[model samples]
Target: MNDDEKTRDYNKAVAAFAKRYLPYKQPLLKTIENFSPELADVVIRHGLYEIWEEMTPLLSYRDKEIATLAALITDNTVMKEITAHTENCLIQGMSKKEVLEILTVLTLYIGVPKIINVMDAVKQAFENYDQHIKNKG
Candidate 1:
């Protein structure tokens, strides 16, 4: 495929990735796409596909997400990432309870106050996942 065709393929992958993992952020992503089309490509490529290809042998995506969630909860990242990461954790192969357990484990180190906020994000992630399932049905 030519560069244009490769870009098109990557764009399709981005759309599907957003639809499946970011079900609630389509509008936000659309706005970003409207503003910076190149960003979505670079982010998707680096954030997910590249990581999976290069790092999965060292850490499975689900494990990476567990660590990602811990970092996000610790304020190592934008707290807003929790919801999406939580869902991604699930999609990558965590059960809901396992995802919740992540938060549970973090509660000791991060404290209840911070954990409460993380819980809210996780709740939203679960809700979004449910909505996606319902819509699929």
Candidate 2:
């Protein structure tokens, strides 16, 4: 493929992947549009599509998202983001028990104090997720 063709294909793949992952949350989309359209595009295109597509074969999406959540929980700087990712992991077909297992294992490396603090957030995420499923049903 020529340079132009390559760029076009990449853009197309990115947009498709973004739609799959982020879909259309109007408020969040609006915030991304208003504040950081470029960053948002990169996240949708490069971050989700390109990067994740490459890594997904090595580790499934659920595993990767769970690992990311554990890391974020350990760092304790991005609890909200972690919550979102945990939710995404669920949407992508990870079981709540599996997610909890990942967190349980993470406590070994991340220490008890951090896990203790973040466990509530994780549980709340699961509870909200269950409620959402019930409402959908």
| TM-score against truth, every candidate | 0.71, 0.74
Task: Give the per-residue lDDT of model 2 (tens digit) for 1-137.
Answer: 57575457456655544433333232564466468867765665466656776546798776777777877888887776766677777877989888888778887887888877877777767776677678878
lDDT of the candidates, in the order given: 0.72, 0.68
Reference-based TM-score, model 2: 0.74
Q: Report the number of the highest-lDDT candidate.
A: 1
- List of clashing residue pairs for candidate 2: none
Give one digit per residue, the lDDT tens place, for model 1 in 4-62: 86566566656556644756666755676677878865665444455544446687666
Which residue runs of candidate 2 sit more than 4 Å off their true CA positions?
1-26
